[model samples]
Target: MKLTVRSSTISEGEWDQFILAESPWAFFQSFAWGETQLLEKVAVARWEFLLDDRKIAQAQTILVKAKRGTFLHVRHGPVVNRELVNDNLLWRQILEFLAAEAKKENAWFCRIGPLLANTQETQRLFANLGVRPAPIHAMDAEYTWVLRLNEAEETILANMRKTTRYLIRQAEKQGVVVKASHQIEDFLRLYNQTAKRQRFVPHRGIEAEFAVFSKRGQAELLVASHSGQQLAAAVILYFGKQAIYHHGASIVSKISASYLLQWHAIKEAKKRGLEWYNFWGIAPEDKLEHPWQGITLFKKGFGGELRSFVHAHDLPVSPLYPVSATIEAVRKRLKHY
Candidate 1:
């Protein structure tokens, strides 16, 4: 088969068309993601793999500079054609190109969080590629909660947990309103407070995420309010065939505003003709006490099946990679996530 890898100049329409056509979709590999990364002043490289004149895959890579070491990060990629899932030669070729790019950038390693199932078969594939599991827990979601929107609205509501349904009703009775807005301030005000209150490092891309995606009408701030008082808010992104609850925050309240907020978001996603409502990352089932447990439970109440992507793998490019790995290993132990 003929193959070619095109860099950075692919048109946005061609890029998004390929991404949206993929099964399950990968927002991390979307054009908006690259734009968001650029907004943070991060270096990004976009690549498309074509075979026989047909686009077969794409990888949107980011250069992550850290005191520990700079590295190449490919989150939830390379979004590939299903037929190429086990094409070892193709994968090796892709990595070779990535490694070359990393070397040029003076990166220590290339990190790939493949968009594949987390299974023994998948593990063996990466193992054969001479890549090791990344020292850091995950660069993206390993386990996500996704609600399929193919069902009728009534059926979808009926599938929700009893308490979830009750909470939604309570929120509506309390006159809570959930509005989809482009106002970043509506999300950041609560989001910043949430970071300090929860004591977790927040991704610094909220402004960038909203600004970049909103430009394409692909993102919104879904805020929940009761009598003009903000109770909960989220920055949701519409990419591929899903609406992803990418970032969220809320204040302590008895109004169940968050519940109503998600309810409407799901409906809005369906209205947009999207096929899925992705609650993004969630704690693994076995890790009941994981830091994400509270939010995981909330996501589960809305009813969805689990989608676990394979753990990230690192392909070393420099001898100093082990030093960076050691630093990250120590960090992992201290982090509950």
Candidate 2:
């Protein structure tokens, strides 16, 4: 097999073509993510592995520069077109290419947080490649909750947990209404308040989020109100056959009626013909002490199957500067940033 690698700067058409033709993981590997990485100033690197003049594999890696050093991260990528991802020759070429790129940039190490479904066999593969699993990054975890769109709305409602369906009905009975809007003020108000309460920095200010929504056809704001008073709000993202619950918040008045608001968002997404609803992240099932106890319980009540990804893993790119990688990881962990 002949192999050659190059930095990828493909057109969006070519990129999405690859995404539509490949598995779910391929979407993340598309150039769209690389563009986002550049916009976010995350120092993105892309590589394509070709064989006998045919494009066979691609990967998109992102790096964040910190006081310690540059910390590399690959989001849900290295999308290979092969039937099985375990082929040694292909893996070897990709791994060598990544290490070389890291070295060229003087990066500390490359961390890969794949959205691929997790398994013991996959873990062993990473181990074979000299990568070690790091502690999980719960907030960045990618989750997809699937709601069947083929069934009648009533059947879909019937499949939901009793209390969930009850909440939707109650919201209707109580006259809580949901609206989709592009108004930045209202959405930001709810988003900022929720972030403060939840103890995480909001990813984007409302204006910035609106700009993102305008460019990417994937996101929207859903606000639920009672008598014109905002009670619950959600920020949803549509991407590659999935509707993701990217962010959401609620006032005390809407707590009881909030489940219905989410249900409505799911229905709206389905009506728009999206394939899946991503609840985003859930605490591990085994970790009873998870901080996400409340939210996880609520998401599970929606009746989506439990799915987990391989915990983030990293490979040493510059063996001479291992301390840089350690310090970078520590700073991110300590800051809760």
Candidate 3:
């Protein structure tokens, strides 16, 4: 009946094992996400709770500081043991502890958008904790386009958009070869090239993935070659039940290789027994004329279900808070930062 809190001194490997084996919402709770956040110098706090019997009940809440106020979030979790997420007493204890931690940090709010799975009791628990469905606080929606990996390559191919299947075969006929690499340098080269070509800024936190790949087995670089020359590359991350396409690059002269590389990555994910191949994200709904149009069409060609999750939500806890949260939203729109 007692509750104990401890800092997350557990090694990355240990944390990963607990996530994969014990938590359904493993992707967000992963050490990979934590490592990424850490490399950005975002303040992170992890607390694990145990029952009187010493059984682990749950672990969660990471704080990322911002110019306005700190953001307290749960990546994919607050993984309470399945048994305890349903128990009223235990769930109450867990929420009280989390609230206290959030207040202590002077955070504006704590936000969590778990992978789309929960029981009725879990919903009730969130409601009881004053967790309302505030779409504004989510960083990324759990709803995503997913390709099932349990089927044969042929079956999977058959399910793809007609254009996607044609492009894959066309790339093969044009002598494109896709290969996997664990080298961080190779991924960086291609990623930077594409970032410049596409007129978007390159992400600053990429080195974190290199650090992770050196220590863990969650990331790989998939490259496509034409006549032995590298033409395209993608950085992919694998965790829990899903394989995610994180970043990509391609030569202007050999764009077909990009198609080949993605196809190869999906095949590899299937071989590794992953349940889903996630095409990370697309614009809110599909608009052919949007700036992200080209990429959106490419992802849709893979023929996965179109889904959308609730938007991010936040709860303010600091004394410097404004009367309305709308000011931040307006600023983002004005400056487009």
Pull out the clashing pairs in model 3. Answer: 28-76, 108-316, 109-315, 135-311, 135-312, 136-312, 137-312, 137-313, 138-312, 138-313
- Candidate 3 overall Cα lDDT vs. reference? 0.69
Report lDDT per candidate: 0.87, 0.70, 0.69
- Cα lDDT, model 2, residue 121: 81
Write down the lDDT that model 2 would get.
0.70
TM-scores vs. true structure, each candidate: 0.95, 0.87, 0.81
Q: How many clashes does each candidate structure show, in the order listed?
A: 0, 1, 10
TM-score of 3: 0.81
Best of the candidates, TM-score = 1
Where does candidate 1 have its weakest 10-residue lDDT segment? 18-27
C-alpha RMSD of each candidate structure in angstroms: 1.6, 3.0, 3.7
Could you tell me the C-alpha RMSD of candidate 3 in Å? 3.7
Error of 1 at 287 (Å): 1.5
Best by lDDT: 1
- Candidate 2: how many backbone clashes? 1
Which lDDT tens digits does candidate 1 get at residues 229-300? 999998888887889998999998878999999999999999999999999888877765568889888999
